[model samples]
Target: MAAFVLRTHDYRTISRCLESYGLAVERSAATWPQRRFTDAAERRRAVATVTALGEDPAGTESAGYFHTRLHLAR
Candidate 1:
């Protein structure tokens, strides 16, 4: 399990990454601005997505941002 951050500017890249990872869009914010993913593959895909976006997973970007955490299902 891992975490990732994606910027809003590169949402297209993130969307592609999620699709490639076989993860579905769980939730999103329209006015406030937010996105979430629960699928494990999506999480991994997010890593690749963020990586492809050229932003450090541990760092922040100029336009958008994304964060992913280990889904500990209860």
Candidate 2:
């Protein structure tokens, strides 16, 4: 099972990325949202693909999918 404990903003970005790739990303309604990749190979592939897209400046991701500005303490 693949689970990610990240900021809601980050998860939304990742969800969009996964959906754009036509991958079914399931989410849990629990306190902490959960995502699972049942197949090891598929899991790795998805991670790799998403990582690459996140690093691309040409895409909506624009070199990073994370929105850390909000997480920083003012």
Candidate 3:
């Protein structure tokens, strides 16, 4: 697994880079049914679920984070 820090976090930007590198990217669907919770406990639980899926919590304040894996031909 190779990890690279991207200068931009836009999906289109990432796609363009992958194309330039001749790499095919398979994107996973985002976790759904996100509900705004009034209780802190509920929010924590939802954040935990997102974390388990390797995604940042929706409540996070920052953006432009990208993580991807590339497959190699044998």
Candidate 4:
């Protein structure tokens, strides 16, 4: 599966990116949000969307394990 590290500051951009990929938000975390894809095409689209948004995509072998990091400017 594909994973990504998205910054909180870019949440909106990422959300838009994911929407572009046709993946709906499945859940959210305190620092990260999770997205589920219905198929491989959606997964690829999600990865591309996040990558285009400048987030680093990390591919993992773990089932239902997508992790991301969030940062806030002080």
RMSD of 2: 13.7
Best by lDDT: 4
lDDT of 3 by residue, 1-74 (tens): 23332212225565667667777655444322323455666556545654665566543412212223233211
Deviation in Å, model 3, residue 7 alpha carbon: 25
| lDDT, residue 27, candidate 2 | 56
Runs with alpha carbons beyond 4 Å of true place in candidate 2: 7-9, 32-74
Find the candidate with the highest TM-score and give its number: 4
Tens digits of per-residue lDDT, candidate 4, 1-74, equal: 13344431346665566767776644333335455556776566666665676655565212222445542221
Candidate 3 segments exceeding 4 Å error: 1-34, 58-74
Q: In candidate 3, how many clashes are counted?
A: 0
Candidates in order have lDDT scores of 0.43, 0.41, 0.42, 0.48
| Tens digit of per-residue lDDT, candidate 1, span 1-74 | 22232342355555556667776543332222245545656556655666676645444221233453222111
Winner on TM-score between 1 and 2 is 1
TM-score of each: 0.34, 0.33, 0.32, 0.38
How are the candidates ranked when ordered by lDDT, highest leading? 4, 1, 3, 2
User: Global lDDT for candidate 1?
Assistant: 0.43
Model 2 TM: 0.33
